[model samples]
Target: MSAPERIPPRGVTTDEPLAGLLTHGELTVRGRIREASNAALYCTVAHEGREAACVYKPVAGERPLWDFPDGNLARREVAAYEVSEATGWGLVPPTVLREGPYGEGMVQLWIEVTTEGDTAELLALVDGEEPEPGWKAIGFADVGDDRTALLVHADDERLRRLAVLDAVINNADRKGGHLLPTAEGRLYGIDHGVTFNTENKLRTLLWGWAGEPLTPEALEVLKGLQDALGAEGALAGRLSALITGAELDATRARVAVLLETGRHPEPSGEWPAIPWPPV
Candidate 1:
């Protein structure tokens, strides 16, 4: 897709105005998905003739509310995707970000794909244990012609380049379970709540190619991203909306470092080697 003329609504971070999804009245506790975090509720709803799986993250509150909490995560994720969009890396599209009664929320296009649900299955697959039919491997390490690739896999080098984009973004949640395999062999990445950390949380299995050279095209894309996202321009302004000043600063520093080095940073000097919730 060509660069979008407008940045997504979710790209903004203020909570004063919420996206008028659901209703003005208090959000009722819709039936929940069995596998989402307690802090969030996953439900299916009808939106414009399509079934949507939306995560309702209530603001940090005393009573349970059906809204987004910590609007920053959604904002940062949207901005991250906005920056990534210029590079044409299709790992994760910048879906909609909106505000809700309790907190800020996001709406994203869902891809139908088969997933195994955890890193152990991924490890087993790497170890030769086969999954049920139709569940193909698509992650960071799964691409390219190297055996020591990181724990993830995708069908081709394009996805691998997107994986590199994700790495530079410091995506803390690059778990095997989060990688989705579509029937077309394209891998769709998900769950970016813990990115843009200032502390350099690089915990990911995609680091299998840490020391390898980035493809020329990938390098050009990164440069493009750096150019579009000025040192203190759109990206910085956008990230400041979703993350703490410190976290945003850290993310910018990390991006700057990646642009300068053209490689993922090693988690040295007391920085954590992995991120929490590796899945």
Candidate 2:
């Protein structure tokens, strides 16, 4: 375990370069992200003078979840990445499911967050009747000692795309901390191991645009996703190796519903709408 190698950061929007690097680069572990429920290792990937920091979550360190009975959270993480790439949103970092030091795992480029722009403070809890302009209300949250506060998230386009993506993947845990804002003013969402469930487990704090009409950009993206998720499409083929058939079908269904309704999703009364510790 030593200091991570530093190299010029690659633009997240230019994903192909980073994807190739993560897919074929040499990996070296630096440390473990102990806060992660699973075995998430902080590492570096380097190839031909191009070096970048990244994270490696090996399958051997996976912790079983009663609901996610498949026991392959690593694959789901990669599956989420594939779906994100299809949307052309790049909400996810460049991630590849490859062999690593311990075993096969999801390797993703590390995101460096800088407080250099407006995208910095996207989520907040306010003591007001409603969220101020440029912010959207998620719901009321219990503060403490019989107190309540209005929880809200920024009304940024990046977050709007993420909300749609979360609905598509049935993300079960989209906590506030999972949103990574870069100095480039770009946003990325991580920790998708519990996503793509066959059920409506879309839990997150980004429910600000619930029931609103889907943006035209999002509609176009969904159209692309619909085509790519078909029986013999490329996206389907890529996801087949990462997720189960039922889950894939569920993903298709979600897209169809979005296209049909032309709106954002609302919470299903069956599951918790917001995750615990909302942030």
Candidate 3:
């Protein structure tokens, strides 16, 4: 099939309007984003004379994971967005699941963030090495061939909040590339299909705050999440539709642990602490 028409990111403000379109819009595949491991189509969605840019990940296109159940990655992606919204952190862009050209799939509003030059340089800094004043070094790793690479994350408050969000979601695949930076300096996290596992698979590149005390602001957010997940609440109900009961329970457990510990988690070392090809 031919790709859908391309629509630039302009006047795409507010989630409700975009979300309504994703839920009930006409989606056309614009092009295939070749960088993704699974099939991901870039498309323009139109509804009621309005148009927006979005990425579509059809369920049939998903590569099965041994640990995760089949045919549900799309739903998990939406669940991550729900958690982000509930916490009011806005770490995730607006996303939703609906029938598309390729059957049921995930449709999320595309975020146009920094993808070259200065942004790349900031993320590639060596670990333990100070970042240009405002930035902070989180962790470092050996990138083979006797070379060591640092895993530095932005020290901005928004990025730090996202680190906590990843921990709660059990995100097993938070590569550096998943962190998107907007023109206005806001950071957004994307590609959350591998999240919400019952296991302790919180692997990511945002360990800069490891073992450090959780800021008051972070603790408050955690508390809010806990409340939102209470029995009969909308957030809890939404999550139930996407992940298993055990996985949902485990997510709450993780939040409780974080609340009790009041600090960033250290790597368990049982599994790979960081994702391969980090950036």
Candidate 4:
């Protein structure tokens, strides 16, 4: 059977179901993986001969301690990915919120496991163990040999553009595991729950060319992204409303800074490492 034309949800952006495509049944939760911050069982789901995976976040509706308010992190994640799709960068894959038996969470396309091994093995390669030539691995690590050209080729234009955005947003969780290199030589970035705000949480290892001028191609991409993001004021406004007043103002400051300077300032120890528990 042919797949239905996928359409993003309208009106209330939060918790928009994936239409009749998903049925009310036990979603086989294989590979129940867990991340550092959120307490959820991530697993792969299959349907109509197509397979995808999602982070099964169990929400008990309890308020948790964190920077951003509780009961809104998942929603922000959905919105961010949706806006990323609109940006036309393909930085983040398409995602939608689904109603699970436990609690409502997001369901995004499972990144095709193309890399040969886990992030640890990839880091081992960075440690001079070298996982063959031309293989790319990604995760959260400092900006050193762990992120050298082996995992990400120096000439990969797409990743270079993504690095710019990562710098601007002050992404804190750019570990080696969050990067996925496809067989077609394209790289996909993931785990963007902390961005858009302006708390100076910037921490990444892709600053090999810091203070250097963006390539003409990369500059064009960034300018185009800013324009596209401007048109979709609805997306940004929604995200801003979810965060605090200071955070919103900070996000605006960051946006302006990115537009003007086009270079991320050095990292600062202002905000905490993680957003909060139950994230």
Candidate 5:
């Protein structure tokens, strides 16, 4: 598949001004993105001479999950974005639920990241001993010939914020491919259809900072989320429209635990701690 087009700077392409356009705009499917298990299509959204590239996930295309109810994955995607925005992290790209050709679904502004070659280069090691600076090793694999390959991720603040976000939301799928780094040096996460489950199912590839103490800034963000999830808060009202009451309560409880402990969580060992195909 061809790479997605590079997105313009946020200053020139803010999602707020185009919110109405994205919700009510005319959608034309450009092509299908086969990498996703669901029916995800690349489409152009146009209204009143303005246009933007967006990924459309029709509800009919969602695969039924044994845990999560069917037909709600699209809403879950939008809920994740809502949480990200509420925290002021901007970790998730702007997403909304709207009508499309197939049916009602979630549509998110497309974010372009560095090419696969660039990602490979970032994860490559030099001298087989030290990784490129600003990267930290998390795991290793035996590549035969007595050689061991190290798994590492960028030592970036944005990624750290995302780690906390995942913890608060109970994200069940955070594959390495979900972490997209744009040319503008910003990191955005995608594919959040399996999040906010009442059961603790936080599978992810972001365990590099596991067991570390949460920074003061991260704690403040958690505090903000806790407040937003209060009974009378707007965020709580928004989430109620998407997920069950028990699930929303579980989300609040997770944030409360994080605030009380002020530490990144350790794997529970009850389930696989990491996603399949870490990268």
Candidate 6:
């Protein structure tokens, strides 16, 4: 069957019933998303006359990672969604774990977005030593040859919230291509398979706000997550099922440190701060 004509829910942005559409629906693989490193199937999920587009990445098709344990990326994707919902940021697209044609894997509602650049509308590679007024500098990038370009991201609140989310999840890869900005103005982040590690693996293109104080709104959300991810806390209970106990504790500790610092984190200098093939 062809992919669904209509898009599905945007994770926590919509009502709860849409999750039902993704969770229990019949999934049909229509095509393969070739750009993804793993086997990402473009599919349509339908249930009780409700149908929407989604992506299914089976565990069997996943490439083994040296750092992360094999066969657990699906759960981490769902865990990322859970944390996104917890923050009330709705950064991740709605995701769930279920059995698919290739075996159990992660299924996420496919978010329809505008045709922008290689990444989202929030990032730009401009020729300058400093970012303009509306943009925040993310350091310089070696474009090619011997020339370098100044990398800057828009000074937007949504991206800031996602930066915080990345820190909380310890997201190892937040490339420009991972950003999804809809025509309607809402932004979503995807490809969370390499997240929630126990180590400080936060790497991304959204480092424009580094060392800046967290927004008041962001601090309030983090305050809520601190409680939700505590021992015996509701978020912690759910995460325990998806990630290892050590990873969960690491997640909690990351949140605590963010709250204590009250600012965006600076790079540790021990690890490569930016991802390769950045976009």
Model 5 stretches astray by more than 4 angstroms: 1-15, 115-117, 120-133, 142-147
RMSD, every candidate, angstroms: 9.2, 2.6, 3.5, 7.4, 4.1, 2.4
List candidate 3 segments past 4 Å from native.
Answer: 1-14, 114-118, 127-133, 142-145
Score every model by TM-score: 0.64, 0.94, 0.90, 0.64, 0.89, 0.94
Model 4 global lDDT (CA atoms, 0 to 1): 0.51
The lDDT of each candidate is: 0.52, 0.88, 0.82, 0.51, 0.82, 0.87
**lDDT (tens digit, per residue) of candidate 2 on 1-279:** 455445545346565666777888899999999888889999989875567989999999998899988639899999998899999988998888999999899998888776663343898889988999999999988889999999889999999999999999999999988988877778889999998888889999989899999999999999999999999899999999998999999999999999999999999888789998776
Residue 144 of model 3, lDDT score: 89
Write the residue-wise lDDT of candidate 5 on 147-246 in tens digits: 8787777777887899899998899988777877777776788999999898999997677778889999999988989999999988999998888898
Compared with the true structure, model 1 gives a TM-score of: 0.64
State the TM-score for model 4: 0.64
lDDT of 4 by residue, 163-268 (tens): 6767644566655567666655445667666555445776554444456566666556556655544535554565554445565455545656665775534445
Tell how far residue 118 is off in model 4, in angstroms. Answer: 8.2
**Candidate 5, residue 26: lDDT:** 86
Worst 10 residues of 5 by lDDT: 4-13
lDDT (tens digit, per residue) of candidate 6 on 1-279: 564445444554566667887889899999999999999999999887778889999988989999997338899999999999988878898898999889999999888775742243588889989998989888898889999999989998888899999999999999888888876677899999999888888898888889999989989998999999988789999998899999998999998999999999888888888898888
After superposition, the stretches of candidate 6 with alpha carbons farther than 4 Å from their true spots are 1-14, 116-120
- lDDT for model 6 comes to 0.87
